[model samples]
Target: MLMFSEDKGKVKFNKPLYGMTGKYTLAEGISLPYFSSLLDIDRAINELRIAEQVPASLEAKWSLKELFQREIDEKRVRQDIVKGYLLDPKKLKFFNAITIVLMPKGADDKILDSFENDSTIPPPTIPWEGNDVEDGQWNHPNARIANFGGVQFISIGLSARLRWDENRVLAVAVDGQHRLSALRTFREDQEFGRSGSLRTHEQETKIPVLFVLLHPDAGFLNVSVQANYSIRRISRELFTDLNKNAKTVDKARELILDDKSINAQCVRTLLTESTTEDIPGLLPLSLVRWQDDFNRFDTSYYLNSLVHLNLLVSEILELKDKELRDPMDKKQVMGFIKSINDALGINGQEVKDGERPLTRYYLEDCCEDEEDPHTPFSRLPEHYLDSAVEGFIVNFRPWLLRLLLDFKPYQELLAYARQYNLIEGNFGKFQAQTSKHKNAILQQENTKDSEWNKREILIPQSAINSMKENQWAFKAIFQKAMIRLGRIIGFEVRSENKNLGNIDDFLNFLNGLYDKGILRVDASLPDHSYRLWTFIALNPGNEKIKVNRAVEDRIFSLLRLWYFGTRKIQIDTAAGEQILSNRKLLQFFAADKNRVHWPGCPEAYETLRKGFDVATLYRKDSNEITIEEKKELVRVRFSAVLAAGLPVLSQLQRGALHEQSSEYYNQDNES
Candidate 1:
């Protein structure tokens, strides 16, 4: 028991708290015990002010936000300590230890130097007096020690004298702020105060702490910081050096998980503990601190990569405080996680068997030395993993989904057109020709088996999986696809002319097109078309590509519908699933790239003329054919065009296509 005397300014302890005992000598004349006690915590909260506040003159030198942000997140700190009790009471225990520094006010420079450097110097006189004046006396008025038989308490001061007084702040907090803040806030909250668990123990609660006594010289203010550095569990520089559940990491995670949005939920799941029932976590259950961990060379790459992806999603959906109740939105958001897992080859079986997961592979591969297993991702020579993540989110995920989803309304329109027997000509022949033209370009680029290579009407699985192997290739394909669609659709897509960094800003630009009547939104998938057109037109995937025409690959497979039908086009349901898998249309595009514009070239009209000529032979009335008859002609004619390998529309025809779609383009561009 450590005892504090109210009248005489003395402290006496019979034994260390929790029966732990250790001590260190500062100077030849002075030494302090490694003490832990309930009284220390109570005294720290009531008596201590941070070192920056002490000595008054040093206050201006320390920035409040920069120096003490640990104190600002009080709610998170409170949740951390009480969360164990709240979630499972049986696991509750003292979360962390408080560390305090005893620095007396205005000590002599020489004496302070001796303590600071761990050099020996003679002891000063004691300030405390016992019942017999000669029996207990030690240092100057700034410090003192009193002994009752074998037990002793050393009082090193932050105030003028080694005394306990309300007017003087006595100690400086070196560590364990989260724990202290939680304890203080729990007592203050009326509800928490009434809680039986906290009230049950009261002052009987004991925590372990390490304390250091420093000389009260201005230079020794840094000594408090030194004490903080000495703690072995925290390594502020390298993330790999951090303990599994560091206080800082825990606090950040709790703060993020507190949100309830679907977007946040997805992020929460990624940062949650890996389980056999769910996907393996890309991030640790307890996240690293952004402020400290971000600046560390070891942790910054992966931390920012994950955080930036979350930011991208949140920005697109406006996820803050917004719950996604719409089935479509929910499906899409959840699918985003599933796509990532599939792309990364994440399997629950592998995780349950204790196999190294995909996320760990990338992180480990990037490290400088494979032999040093402790610092898992401490030395990434190049940030390839981060680039891969960015590429997946920006290029493959959104772009692929756009092609699949935007076709919904078109499919509905095509079905309506088919039912009424109002179809004209062999537009299907024109669509197949368009697919050939696009696939030729992809093949030219040496990208075998790509969406373009297969003449895909939907996003391909190869496109999604390729992101892992070559993010740059995916980036190139994405940029090229966008510019091609923009030009083919007659939109003078100027990447440089847009505010293209934020996903939301780019989406707004697409909505402006809808507002202008150049494009239409399938009310069921509101942001689909906006995402599709802008994703390519704005070239949002690759930041390295300047918004220019040079990167555009003239492979506009998405333009097939415009030449084939004025209505929205629909593909077979079986094909849609085989192509899109779990991907949602919102993840891809809102409307068909074909719906926005027609290729204005003479070559396009020429091809349509041939299709019309073929359909004319099958018409009931010379000018038109029924849906069934039109389909038969289209299938036969388009197969012939594909086999014959005729040019669909060359770049030479680009000028003509631009002229044709110019009116539609201008309507939306101006709006």
Candidate 2:
């Protein structure tokens, strides 16, 4: 008999189990022993189950394959582990604890009876004199078992050994699946004599394992009855939570899961509550890719990725890099306010030297830490962090949404998608379709079948290709450019700057640009004389538009000049002055061959001339000059400027611009 006991009372058992067991408290205040043990590599590979192979239980109607565990990469198992770790057994090889959930295969009526009766069974005591106990339980002098508060408690010392019967429980991995897979591969290869240099002793190595047992009262073990909480759902939730908290997880996943980062939390709120009545989210989840951090939006159906969206949110809220990475703090809040004031050109009362600056913006109440002035900004109190996150979301959400929706291209795209039934009005169907599309793509990739590919085609291929060509409006660079411009406009609106126009005026200006084809991929002059996009911001020959700081700044400057003209809003900054005064524009046209013959050049010059007082081509030095002389002078200056800005010939066009000057230079060099 195994002789399992409860509170000094011995109870005989048919099967014996072993491990070092102790209580661990969960979020719901349910305490259970997370059993820890070391198992031989062979036994672990055979006995333990991954999510993909978990057997069905009466409590769970569906399979555990729906868990968020990533599929194991065979190549990684072969190269990084089998070839790297096991091949070098001489070096110290260690593995982290593989977390597993030990779920009962079926309901034990006795345990259910104990829970139903609300039993308070006393702890069992073991006689000190025995080596007569079960083989593994002999060393556990202090081990005791009891049933209280609808949970069975098995208390034992850290060094004590308790038996684990693999037949009675289903052990499914909640974390470290990849490591387990790699070990299984290594074992298989060793058996087949394919493991190059792994020794026989290495195959007998033991790995650390942690077995989590949920409280019996949580209803996870009551397999006979249907309930809200089940082993499948709980285990899946645990898997997701574990990976989401791990440092090795990707940033995009972190943004979706991180509660500590205010920026990330705000992003989640925007995505989840996008269609809510209180907060109308303009950027639907269907239009945003929340998976990988790659910025190749031009090729995908998504307009933006989560990483860039987080960055945009951070920028819009004026969050510092440190704040984005860490928790928001009072010091960071102060800094953010300072930045806001600077953006709006709000110069508060000047402070004297050697004194703290004036608090121009309202500061939220927070407990002050006087002990350490340089305490980490992330260490702010919980209440303060909560207040900060809530305040930011409430204040900035409307502005951010309006800014995104006000952009002409975004509005047009939304309307078009809605018209084609590609997106739902309330976004409910769109989200479901997005999830279906993602799953279909995954299935297609995994199966390598064209049938799966058909299911994955949510959007028409022709439409996708057209969107790719017209991706200029949806590119990250373009979105960021709009955000930067919107930031200025938002500040002007909030500060009630006189030069700031109403929403209608802003809309009209954007619509005018759209109508002129300036925002299109093929934006150019009427006769295809010159590419207007090239003259403005885009590189001459690039296919995909990338994030270029210089290019973005140029775009902002040009838009500000054209939209606001030479008013105070346009010429307030040095950059604005340079563009509006025609100095920078003239220099740009004179230097860049691509801009001299641009159709907008003359209009731009005329705008500058009207905005600022400047001399014409004719000099006022000689009054004796005739009207024809003035005309000749004007023509000569125009011809010289045009000639200076002419494009240089390519190697293919080498003899295309043949000139006598070039021939004379050649003859002089030969002589």
Candidate 3:
């Protein structure tokens, strides 16, 4: 066991720990030799009375000494560090040398003997020198001594002080006591094997220690605290990957150096330089739970979510076919960033950091009174049209592409209808907030101009222009299209209770729908039963059965006019704020639990294509007929068509049930 020398002021060693060893002075009164070796740390555990705490009820004489009397559980030390080391000796290479502070009980001048020059061994290399060295500086050079001791005591830098006479503790461990205890336990065969004698013939292991001598001075106690607590250590995350130089900062630097994309560059800029008054990376950094060492060149406190953000951006740029969008070059991606920033009202003048993007930008001031039809979301709330943006795109992109693929003929037909007023509704007045003249239609001389000045054409300019001119029209059109699509296939999307009002209320309602499995829009098709619209695209290879793109666009345009322009159903009203009490009118399109169908049922579409005017089913003006009178007319005209498809639907439902039964029986037999 390592212990104090016979002199009590110096550290004693039975044999040389490493090939070279000597003693040297550090600062004015401290000095010790430093070397690296395997240490039996278990033999060096020391508990010293370091501090005290007194309760309010006790007198002031209780003193502060009781604070340091708290004992460390040695078993915890063995389990955490020692057992792992014995199992794999390779783990022993990481710990620094143990520190021992020796305070001789009485004033011992002989302790300074080691601080003096030793003629027997070569002089030690001290780390620091000159007047810069203060008394408390741990790395200060050793002061020269006048006496020469026969025994060689080498001090490279590690040292401890000893307090004699006052306490028989003799020596105290300032650091690494757990390591010492674990070493002791392993040595005593309390670890590794059942018999514990498997490693009895092991080679001698030595631990390098620094020894300092002090004469029980108050200054020495302060020095012990300073020695143990002052030095800053690397973070655990950085320390584990030290061999590969893998640190948070390093990863950030790599992204800046290799990835020159605008988004990546923005991330780099946020980490490296403060572009705004506040730290640009603060919000992102706050989300990070780990960081690299402070001394690392690329030590970033904030780049933890950089990877997730980049991945999201990448996905947003992909085409419906899962291919990289040909139009999404660097310039296009930058444009998208600017557009998103504009939509969120995030001015690029200052990059806000350390905030949740969704909460800060999207959810602010969105919820409002549903009774008011004047308000609209500040940004285009397309995501609110569906619960999941990914699912929304998946369902709509194919449908949209099929429509846009042959849009020229559809546009001409719309132009013809507008010019002649042949459609059911009049597009003669403007009800949008953007327009000054309430009664005049906003006519664009350059009708083909791009809406946002971006070079992309996913949908027709005429359609986009109409929607932008009146956002209320867009919401009405979107619902009509959804209902029409649902009718063509046999699925019903809207529920009576789920009818919500306005954009914000609808967003909340969609969230509820998602929870109730009503709007379970996910990527997996086989697991989803609500995606009846997808079946149109899944039609078997028969070209005759497949719906044509021009036909689809015509139907979509027809429904938009039939609902928004003719029926004049305000966005909030259709959203379910004030329930449309026309149950007879709704039953003509929307399906109940038993019979599933929507507005654009194929038979209904055939009826409309044969030049049937939908305005004939409902009252256009109160002067002509009352709501109840129109409801009677609608019920009479659509009762037969509503019941016509029941036989086909029943046949399909029966076949599906039989297939499900067969699959379950097969699985049960196999099990």
Per lDDT, the best of the predicted structures is 2
Model 1 per-residue lDDT tens digits across residues 214-313: 3322212333345443211221211222222455543334336433233334344333242111122233221222222121111211112234334434
The lDDT for every candidate, in the order shown, is: 0.33, 0.50, 0.31
189-265: candidate 2 lDDT, tens digit per residue: 65436454435786568888887766453223433333445555667787888887876867787887665566777
What TM-score does prediction 1 earn? 0.36
Model 1, poorest ten-residue lDDT window?
Answer: 581-590
Q: In model 3, which runs have C-alpha deviations exceeding 4 angstroms?
A: 1-70, 88-93, 105-169, 189-191, 194-204, 215-671
Report the C-alpha lDDT of model 3 over 1-671, residue by residue, as the tens digit.
Answer: 33333434433323223223234455655443422333343333222211111122221332212312233454455434544345554443445565444322212211221122234433212211233333224233563211122222333333332212211213334444455555545655543553333243343444666433332221222343344421111111112233235224544344444322333433333232321122321222222211221211112112123443333223322322222142223333334334443322222221122343322323242222422222222222222212223322333223332231112322333354334332222221111112444212223312455342222212232443432231111122232333343323211232332322222333333233223332221212223322221222222223122335434444353332233211223443556654222222233233223123223333333333232223433436656777445434433332222212122222233223222233322322232
In order of listing, the candidates' clash counts read 23, 15, 48
- Candidate 2's TM-score reads 0.46
Those runs of model 1 whose alpha carbons end farther than 4 Å from true positions after fitting are: 1-94, 105-169, 189-191, 194-198, 202-204, 215-265, 268-317, 321-567, 571-671
Candidate ranking under TM-score, highest first, comes to 2, 1, 3
User: Distance from true position, residue 554, model 3, in Å?
Assistant: 42
Using TM-score as the measure, which candidate wins?
2
Candidates ranked by lDDT, best first? 2, 1, 3
Whichever of 1 and 2 has more lDDT, that candidate is 2
